[model samples]
Target chain A: MSPTREEIAKLASSPAHEARLLCRHNLVDTTSGLAGDYVQANLVILPSAYADDFRMLCARNPVPCPILGATPVGNPKRIIPDACISSDKDDFDIRTDFPCYHVFSTIESDGKKKVIIEKKTNLLNDWTDDHIGFLIGCSFSFEQALSQRGLRLCHQEDNKVVAMYQTKIPLLPAGIFHGSGFVVSMRTFQPEEVELVRDITRPYLAAHGEPVAWGWDGAQSIGVEDINKVNYGDAQTIREGEIPVFWGCGVTPQFAVEKALERDAIKGTVMSHQPGRMLVTDWKIVDFLKYTQEQLGLSR
Target chain B: MSPTREEIAKLASSPAHEARLLCRHNLVDTTSGLAGDYVQANLVILPSAYADDFRMLCARNPVPCPILGATPVGNPKRIIPDACISSDKDDFDIRTDFPCYHVFSTIESDGKKKVIIEKKTNLLNDWTDDHIGFLIGCSFSFEQALSQRGLRLCHQEDNKVVAMYQTKIPLLPAGIFHGSGFVVSMRTFQPEEVELVRDITRPYLAAHGEPVAWGWDGAQSIGVEDINKVNYGDAQTIREGEIPVFWGCGVTPQFAVEKALERDAIKGTVMSHQPGRMLVTDWKIVDFLKYTQEQLGLSR
Candidate 1:
């Protein structure tokens, strides 16, 4: 029998074990709220031919695509040992860690380019020696941090994906990865909670950091035309006194990949973890704090 | 008549004016103590073929080589308009702004590859359409900050170049720019003032940040074999009750360039600003503080 939601939550306390359970059961749902306190990452796997440009892309658009770790070409193991797990019985595998994978392929149909997305349990048959994997920071890390401070996330309470939208702000272009604008995810909070939310999220620099914009007025500053209409994820109703807060979203890279395909800049297949299905790593929320401490030379 | 030191100091209060004066008179002396409160940079110009690898090198080894700005290929003007010069000049020529430049050439002799350094007033004849300029952060910015807080740098008092040493700590490799180790500049301070010094310098992330290691034992931790055998600059005596603190030095990238040439990873000339002849930028010391403020979302 499959594990219950409560059992999954309990198993999530141990990220490695939780990832194993999800992989073994081949669960296709989102990984949100599963591995509490541990770092969950958005995965992007590309052919080695496009690796350098994609690395530059992440470096140029750090806010939306903060790279936590990258594997060498043809390597499937995590950069850090046991950072991601496939199953309880097998070694950590990038192909099967996440609940589902989205494989994107560009095809020529009727003298026009069309993108086809295929959902698969793993990339076992699709894996190649020339593939490289990039694990990027997810805003879920900071969302958990905000929740700990008593700032309730409306989407989690309502059991829906956070609303995401494309913005007018253009990302700094690098190499062939150009022309794609910034994408953001939105949440609503009481007006009084904005400062506290910013304070709580700013420390997680690897995870998109603080809100790019707050309130409807601030949203328009970044050229968000409508709060109800979103480019990705489910839109939630804004309460009477709640303000709309926007943050750099992990979905931005997927959009950039699509843009690259449109321009014929990328020729091979590009793979990403399904929107809510993330690769759970061994890193804790406090690891970012530790990095800051080390940077400041406070720790031995 | 030549301007007095006081006149030059006063003139340096404005970076643009100082740059023009330096360019016109060809003042090839150390720029230290001239431009107070302004940021100084180490300049490196390479051919377009090697620009991407060099950029990756800077990204991978940020501590030793924090990039302040990079000019687009074939562009001699600063990346930010009027950011690096005083408009009071006849030209915004990068070739003649500093005291001197070091042009490195690779030569093969006796079945061994060797590097020859040539000192030039500018790269006037050497400038080409394929050259890209990289301005790296210099420690002088934070050193000035430390001086403001009553930390006396001994070498500055004696009018000598700061002592520098090459270490066994290998830098994170990027493409052809690999195999070079870290180089550090050492400063001595009384044991009681170590923490305060660390605290003051930690905020200047762009200018090498805090000390990588402190004291005699700490120096050994990073693989400094001997203190007396200096690699690049003048060595100062360690007074009783004083501890030696080491910080990342800008000289590292120059050393890396030489290493690259030795292995033939780099072809063609590599140009760099002569030691102590830095490119003064229009940025204030406090600009870095503002960056931190913005990163933390405290200034929004």
Candidate 2:
């Protein structure tokens, strides 16, 4: 059965500590369709100065790079008085919670043309006071939005990955971190309902409104041409009247970080699970704001 | 000079009689950047039955179709007693907002495609007692978020159209009305700032978070493979050390609506503007929500 608001709330409020531990221990591998209603995220940890720039970047770009919480300088859990919830009160450690980890290192002597992107394991030991843990929001939230709207998720049906592509769309960069553009994820829907789908999701982009494009033939779709060959997941079948829509993906930053992963920019930390897995905070946005409200003594 | 908060307030809070004048005499033109504080939306007047399904779709997807207000069947103004924003003093007609209009004829059929994907400009005379007007949030709101965050908009800077892309993502489909997946708009920023950009915007999309991808090597960025040949809008330059960031754009629905038009899903209606330009309302989100005290709601 699908998780309910009540069950999800309980998990967020209590036992979530164990829940994350369970996931980390591989006791719970698929957070994919579980412990929902709580916010999940994409994790990217880096050094402090880069952390500062990255934080600003998330601030500038927002939507994807949501920082759930940040650890203090050299401290694993930089305690924020009010987190989403208190149940499994986050020890605020980026070192754990995440079941999987990808530690990245940049090679100094590699020629620009011969550059290769590689990843290792976790980086708990080489911790620097400058390290920053950034938790980003995912399309998973949109998945919830879709489910609420009764839109069937094809990936669930096909038991496949959400089709993602590298779009020509460029992204905002900061500091020495000159990065490339985003690799957007795409989903298909009937052409007729395109507006209906757009109307429903756009405002949901935090009132920014949704979708950058729709209805255009997919064959010619590319911000920077020839990028279609690269993909993170397999593509799905496009129906007779189906129109493909593209969204900015979280991989945008990882690509950016890769470019900026200079020796000075060199820093490492554990990577979070796929976009589906999130650290359910004890706080719902409404309640999260309400809690912040009480803390600030908001009279109303 | 840029409009001030007080000036904007004065204009937004002006009596309906005067606000209507802005509509008349084509005064609302040069609306390129007006009332950035509030929402401006596309106005679509349609028959009531189609309105029902559209409403269902909107309700199903509140993110893109945030129903700020609606007009009664016979009411020329949306400030109807039974309307959503009945108390909003900005009660005005949708007829005059846009500089142009397009009327759809159910009989105007080109059997070739049986549907079309273009904006309708006029059809007020065809309005029946059963017509309804839809008010949706637009990209102007997020432009505020972007402009305030120091993420310079290439559009605003060059006085050009925002770069957009048509991609593989699809919108969620609805009855007679198909939906879209993710639509992305492009913006550029340096790499390190990417995280901050994402962080700032995450809370807003707490429901969905933000962009799906971030990339570094343009080739690997977006997981796709392209940029030069875009789906829409002119391409901009990426400076020596900058990365491009993508976000959800309001045009997602426009494509859907056009596709619907082409398909005759429900004779498209064109009253004024696109979905994202929200009608500046009497209430601001910050004033209504108490959580914006920090950083004065700018996320600085």
For candidate 2, the TM-score is 0.53
> Candidate 1 — what's its lDDT?
0.73
lDDT of 2 by residue, A1-300 (tens): 434444544554355554555544444433444454555556676666566556645544544344455555566564343564366554445565655555655454755322244332334665566665666655544556666777766665676566666554444444445445555666677777666666565433321224545555443444523323436655666667666776556655676666665424544542433433345444443343344334322223
- State which docking tier applies to candidate 2: incorrect
Which lDDT tens digits does candidate 1 get at residues A21-72?
5754676366667666777788888888876566655654566788888766
CAPRI quality level assigned to candidate 1 from its DockQ score: incorrect
TM-score of 1: 0.54
In angstroms, the error of model 2 at B45 is 4.6
C-alpha lDDT score of every prediction, in listed order: 0.73, 0.50
Candidate 1 colliding pairs:
B16-B86
